[model samples]
Target: MGIGARALRQRVRTAESEDWDFSEGRIFGSMCTQPAPAAVAAARRFVTSNLGNPGLAPGTARLEEEVVAVLLDLFHGPAFGAGGWVLSGGTEANITALWMARNASRKREVVLPESAHFSFVKAIDLLGLEPRWVPLDDQGRASLEDARKAIGPRTAAVVAIAGSTELGAVDPIPALAELARAHGVPLHVDAAFGGFVLPWAGPAAASVPFDLAVPGVTSLAVDPHKMGMAPVPAGVLLVRHREMARSIAVASPYLSSPQTTGLLGTRASSAVAATYAALMGLGHRGYASNVRRVLDLTAQLLAGGRALGLRPAVEPTMNIVAFLHRNPVAVQTWMLERGWDVSSVSAPSSLRFVVMPHATRGTVAALLRDLGSALRRFPP
Candidate 1:
């Protein structure tokens, strides 16, 4: 016998009780965060609407167009031409961009930074393209010299990261763009994390330039669900020229639309509406304020870590801070025991904290207190 709605809801809640306590503000291991109120409301309004076939669902398609236009403006690209589409977060966006590169170029090799997101590796494997990995410089950015050495006759594309997963490093995007342009190769910037935060980072924006303003940037990917605080699975991949996207397009005969722009046949237009609402609601000033606060919290956390004798893996340019500890596993266990959510990095044997909107100052201070106590018990 099937259970009633109330009973089913109760059972689901009981199962979800084991999850992290978002209300207590202890979680700091990932980019995921609670959606903004405006975005949530927008999603609720359009959750049942699908824009899979723009010709059939004209109204939903219009919402998607507005979302894309807003995103292009945010990324410093042209609002006209609508040279991009919303997809299912970073993985799909990255794969889609790589697929375009693979088809557009004669060569089958992609040169990427060692610090590039793992999604690129997945794309390389899936697309049957060779990976020419370039090492990072001392500052944890893709080394221009290394990139120059790595790219050769078979180099189809060069990939750069704006916000690296582990270190939160911003590659020298303009330099990479220059190199790619000179070699007649396409440059794709994976700014999924930084794309939403970096534009309004105030003085910090001077150091990071992974955007459409850079002349040689052929394509770019961004995730509205990350820093934009939109609902999940709202990623966008943009091409500088419309022809680049058309090169990888497939014919879709059955649908009202003649061609399919993305890998999936059916897509949630609710995500696009929510993303558009987020961008419009937050505006430039709102995001700048949010990013500024996160930066302050990050500084406080870094100071607290240093006080406990923890060494930072890199000087963070973004909200993510990774620090080296003697025993990361033990630290993680101790934090978990105290009801404080924390995570560790494998390569540097370190702990990482991502400062999001939920990680308030008071919660961060409490985290520091807990870390101090944990360190005293398990010293580095």
Candidate 2:
């Protein structure tokens, strides 16, 4: 007395249809986009593989290793002694990095900027560590002078952001690294959104040092699922030295691997395969092309907003753009009513737009039309 596979498929499709499709390009609020076709196909092929027990899925484990190696190289980590793992996402990666820092230093305080991602809040709470919050400057970047004041004997780590969540602000990582080095504390860079985009973002981004190549950076987190066009739940954590990761390893007697380094025990290997596929298929030139395309679209969005008499909170450093709005909540509601999904930020009271890969010229034009209408209705 059970429904057959055909009926189940039909019912699932019917339910899924009610959700917003990224292909339609109305999902302006999300960091994720429609995954690359090659990545999706690769994921389906390895759906049954589990990387947690490497003994069981050796092929998938090797793929994960290759993915990590490529990402480390991209971040300019040392070729041989560096270590990395593919975790669930940025939150887990951030927590794991902080946990390692706390354990290694045996300290309780973490120095971070106000613009850091909310994931740091969870990490601090879970690890029983105190946070020394640094204020942001007029440009929304973390104040370097304040950060120097915050670092002290009890500081376990210094957290810098390469790409912040709400404002897409890239903190001055090289200077922060110098500060952390002076204090003898690990500096962790959360580059979840910018890691992939910044590498190919042309000359402006080239001058910023936000990776392991910078002297004092100990660990860094980047998400392949964000700008890499990979499936969700694919985050990479790269450490400057392999021994730094040893602080968090726990023995797993039941699993094929002697120890598990990440928070999850049964991780989906499909994500690993998809990440590898996306990285290999796109290569350097392909990603550079994609980044240029999105950045161009971002410029269009900014110009369109300016034409509507709306000003941006800050000049965008990445694909994410935000406009200063008097009534952000009302504008968000108005857009939602018209089937356009966008987000709002509280710090500067702005409406946010993330131009992911799914967003095209046509979609951006449509969104601007609707946004203009919303602005007129709300008079923001």
Per-residue lDDT over 140-181 for candidate 1, one digit per residue giving the tens place of the 0 to 100 score: 789999999999889989999998888888999999999999
Q: What is the TM-score of each candidate against the true structure?
A: 0.95, 0.98
Worst 10 contiguous positions by lDDT, candidate 1: 74-83
Top TM-score model: 2
For each candidate, the alpha-carbon lDDT, in order, equals 0.85, 0.92
The residue pairs found clashing in candidate 1 are none
Best candidate, lDDT-wise? 2
lDDT of 2 by residue, 5-89 (tens): 9999999999999988999999999999999999999999988888889999999889988998999989999877998988888
lDDT (C-alpha) at residue 215 in model 2: 96
Model 2 residue 135 CA deviation (Å) reads 0.8
lDDT of 1: 0.85
